[model samples]
Target: MTFSKDEQPKNIPESNTTDNVAVPKNFLIPFLLLSLKQWNMHGYKLMQVLLDLGFTTIDSSNVYRTLRQLEKDHYIKSNWEQGEEGPAKRIYSITEEGEAFLKTCHSSFLQYQQMLQTFFSIYTNSLFPISNFTDKND
Candidate 1:
């Protein structure tokens, strides 16, 4: 059968669902540890930091759960500080183990970044040949 250039490709299938599943709860541990590595913070401050980092949909319960897991794993330690105006807050800090783990995560993230750069370079170059062809006259 003949088809126009705008027609859908014969081999590709269409799907109606596009909603993305949530990132797993455990996924927040590394981020929490990394944040704590920079400074000791309470739950609210940590949540604010995460929100500022673009995690606006994160639930408070998830943050607290991750905090508990991190403490259980010995990656973080927390202490209660009595606030003058309100209830005591639990301040979290990264333990030595957490620092080491953060280093490993940082290295892995760097490698992943390099891999993504290489992949995109090849993929985009192949997809758009004109991207590599510069106008020398300019």
Candidate 2:
């Protein structure tokens, strides 16, 4: 059900659903950084490594674009590696900044994981009560 602006409840906040995001923004960043931290590799290999790690629904274009952005943001660095039997490949490695960012992301995700656990526990437990959630506006 869609709500028109005029018909929407004043007390309810605007919804920013997952639909607004093609994929969770940077959901793949830490994985990419962590992969680089472990072993520097070219884009194709990196994606393969990620797939091996059980990450699905990955878009190649988005991965390349994100890699370029990471390079621009100084989180990662790439250099062209001349292949013996193939064309040169751009090797990606995590910078110190990227490693630091990955650590931060790990910590934040742990906390988020806890919150999700709590949510699921409450959702699955019959002891849960809808009235436990009180509107701040009240």
Q: On residues 1-138, what C-alpha lDDT tens digit does candidate 1 reach at each position?
A: 345656857553333343434444545777888889899999999989876755646799978988898899899999999989899999999999999988888888799889999999988888788746888887
Q: Please give the CA lDDT of all the candidate structures.
A: 0.82, 0.85
Highest TM-score among the candidates is held by which one? 1
For model 1 the local lDDT of residue 43 reads 96
lDDT of 2 by residue, 6-30 (tens): 9888755468564333345567898
Error of 2 at 106 (Å): 1.1
After superposition, which runs of candidate 2 have C-alpha atoms over 4 Å from their true positions? 1-23, 127-138
Distance (Å) between predicted and true CA of 69, model 1?
Answer: 0.7
Candidate 2, residue 89: lDDT:
95
Instruction: Give the candidate number with the greatest lDDT.
Output: 2
